[model samples]
Structure formats: C-alpha cells, structure tokens
Target: MKRPIRVLVAKVGLDGHDRGAKVIATSLRDAGMEVIYTGLRQTPEMVVNTALQEDVDAIGISILSGAHMTVFPKVMELMKQKELTDVLVTGGGIIPEADIKKLQEIGVGELFPPGTAMKDIVSYIEEWVAENRNF
Candidate 1:
C-alpha cells in the first residue's frame, strides 16, 4: 500500500497563537493525510529541520505575528540548503496580497488567507503532493 501524504504544520517565530494550526492539522488528518504539528514559537531552523526529519510532502506555516516575510523566506532558504526541492512550502495568515505574490515568486506555494475553506486546503496539498512528490 502507498504511504499517506505527510504534512508538517508549523507556527514560526514569536507567534504564540496556534488554534488555526491545530484546526488545519485535524482537518488534514480527517482528509487522510498524516500531519505533524510543531507547536508555537518555533524558529525557521527548527521547523525546517523537523520537516526534514519527518519527511513531509508539504509544510504549512501558520503565521499571525506579521512575520510572514521573514519566516517564509528563511524557511525556503533552509529547505533549499537542505535539498528539499520537492517539498511544497505553503502557509496562511494575515499576509497581504502583494506579500503573497512576493512569497510565491520566491518558490513558496499557494497561500490561503483567513476564511479559506478547509476542503480547499486539503485538496491543494493533495494535488501538490501528487504532482511533485515521487511517493
């Protein structure tokens, strides 16, 4: 049998809020993906290292601390340095449209804003894994 899609859901930096991360983790689990959630106040290094260790197909960052700019790029750089080329790096939070475009330009995947449906998030991750991960 094929292994289930694995995702690492993380809250990077000084963001102590994690309710949304928990909700997304549970929703992804219900959608049949294996989820590993790294709890609050994690650094970019910690998140990426954990992703590498967990061998996740995707990394979902929940950043409400307005550090999306710093956090996403740092994670992307680390992912690159660690040779995680196929791992989808996606996230959601209070990021602005321009910032989202900037992040996507730097290789971050589709980012959902607040109020995005859970089904969409699940499907996006599934589709990304299907297209990118070799399984």
Candidate 2:
C-alpha cells in the first residue's frame, strides 16, 4: 500500500486563533494524510526544522496574524538555506489575493481563503504530493 502523504501543519507567529488550522488538520487527517500540527506561536525556523526532523512531505502554515508576508517568506528562505526545497509550502487565512499570487509565484504551492471547501484543500494536497513526492 502507498504510504499516505505526511504533512506538518503549523500556526506561526502571534496567530492566536487556531480554529481554522485545527479544522484543516482534521480534514487532512480524515483525508488519509498523516498530519503533525505544531500548535500555535511557532517561528518560521521552528516550522521548517520540525518539517525536516519529521520528514514530512509538505508544510501547511495557517496564519491569521497578518504576518504572512514575513512568516511565509521567511519559511521559504530558511527552507532554501537548509537545502529543503523538496518540501511543499502552502497555507491560508486572511491573506489578500495579491499577496497570495505573489506567494504562489515564489513557490508557495497554493493558498486557501475563507470558505474554501475542505474537500478542495484535501484534494489539492493529495494530488500535489502524489506528483511532487518524487523526493
């Protein structure tokens, strides 16, 4: 049997509201991916380190702290620094459309917004990992 995709879902920075992150985690778990949630107030370095240590295929960061610009880019920069280009970085929450596009251009796989159907997020990650997990 194929092993399910392993994802490290984390809440970064001062994002205190975790209701959405928890929801995504549960949805992904139900979709058969092994999810490791790092709870709240995590730094970009910590999230990347945990992803490497856990050997997860993807990193899903849920941030509502309005720090996605800093946090997401920082995570990507550190991932490059740690030679971790293989891990997929995707996330959502209170992010404007313009920033989302910019993030995607810089290699953030995808961005989900409020009311994005959970099934779509699940499918997106599953298909992406299935194709990108060549690592």
Candidate 3:
C-alpha cells in the first residue's frame, strides 16, 4: 500500500499564535494525511531540517507575525540547498495578495489566506501530491 501524504506544519519566527497551525495540522490529519507540527517560534532552518528529517511531502507554514516575506524565501532557499525539490512549500496567514504573488513567483506553491476553506486546503495538497510526488 502507498504511504499516506506527510506534511510538516510549522510556525516560523516568533509567531506565538498557534491556534491556526494546530487547526491545520488536525484538519490535515483528519483528511488522512500525516501531520508533524513543530510548534511555535521555529526558524526557517529548523523547519526545513525537520521537514527533511521527517521526509515530508510538504511544508505548511502558518505565519501571522508579518514575516511572510522573510520566512517563505528563507525556507525556499533552504529547501533548495537541501535538494528538497519535490517537496511543496505552501502556507497561509495574514499575507497580502501581492506578497503571495511574489512568493509564488519564487516557486512557493499556492498560499491560502485567512478564512480559506479547510476542504480547499486539503484538496490542493492532495492534488499537488498526486501530481508531483512519485509514490
């Protein structure tokens, strides 16, 4: 049997609010995906390292401290350095639309904003894994 989709949901860089990250982790678990939540105040390096160690299919960052610009790019860079090319780096928070576009331009995947439906997030990850990950 194929392994379940594995995702590392993280809160990077002093983001003390963890309710959303926990919610996403639980929701993904309920959707039959394995979720590893790294809790609060993680660095980009730490998150990527954990993703590598966990062999996760994706990294879902929950940022509400207005550090999307720095966090996403740093994670992307680390992923590149670690040759985690097949892993999806996607996330959600209070990010502006323009910043989302910019992040996407840098190879970050679809980023949901606040209030995005849980089903949508689940579906996106499912489809992405189906298409991108070689099971």
Candidate 4:
C-alpha cells in the first residue's frame, strides 16, 4: 500500500500569524497527506526534532517574522546535523526573491509567498518527495 505523505507544518521564530499555516496544513491534509502542525513561536530545533520523531517526509514552515534567512538555514542545518537529509524543507512567507534563490541553492526547497495556490504546494511536495526521497 502506498503511504500518504506525512508533513510537519511549523511556525518558526516569533511569527504568530498562523492563518496561512493553518490553511496550508488543511490543504495538505485534504490532499491525503498526514500533517502535524507545530504551533507558534517554534525554534528551528523544535521543528527539526518534531520532524525527526514524527518521521515526516517533508516540513512546511510558515514564517512571516522576517527571520526566514536565519530560521530556514537553521532548520536546514539541523536537518543536516541530525542527518535528516532525506526530509524535505520548504516554507512560505515574506522572503525576498533573491533570498529565495539563495535558500534553494543551499538545499532548502521552494519558498511560497502569500497567494500561492495550495495545489501548487501540494503538487510540488508530491513531486519532490517522489524524486528525492531515498526510500
């Protein structure tokens, strides 16, 4: 049997606006993925740890606190530090386009800003997991 994709949707740093995160989480869930939401004010470590323990296929971090640079890299670093490279890391927020490019360059996946269709994120994850998942 094919497993439903499991995803951890997290809010990092002081970003308290979770309406977007909740929306994405619901969309991903409705798309037949298991979702765990790590609520507001989560550290990168918390997110990586949760993803590790949950054994998620991907992590969707919703960041609006202008800390995408620090938080995304930290999460990516932790994912590497803990050897969670098989887990995909992506996010949505107010990140600049240039920074988004840089993040992708460093191995963080896509960064979706507001107004991105939920289906796009879901499809992106599906394809990414299929291509990148080691097992």
Could you tell me which 10 consecutive residues in candidate 2 have the lowest summed lDDT?
A: 126-135
* TM-score for each predicted model, relative to the true structure: 0.98, 0.96, 0.99, 0.97
Clash count for candidate 3 is 0
Instruction: Please tell me which model should have the higher TM-score, number 2 or number 4.
Output: 4
lDDT of 3 by residue, 6-104 (tens): 999999998899999999999999999999999899999999999989999999999999999999999999889989999999999999999999999
Task: List the candidate numbers ranked by TM-score, top first.
Answer: 3, 1, 4, 2
Off by over 4 Å in 1: none
**Each model's backbone clash number:** 0, 0, 0, 0
Instruction: Give me the candidate number with maximum lDDT.
Output: 3
Regions of model 4 farther than 4 Å from truth: none
lDDT of 4 by residue, 1-135 (tens): 678899999998887899999999999999999999999999999999999899999999998888888988889888999999888899898999999999999999889999999999999999999998855
- Relative to the true structure, how large is the alpha-carbon lDDT of every model? 0.94, 0.91, 0.95, 0.92
Q: Give the clashing residue pairs of candidate 4, or none.
A: none
lDDT of 1 by residue, 1-135 (tens): 789999999999888989999999999999999999999889999998999899999999998999999999999999999998999999998999999999999999999998999999999999989988997
Error of 1 at 46 (Å): 0.4
Candidate 2 lDDT for residue 34: 96
Candidate 2, residue 35: how far the Cα is off, in Å:
0.5
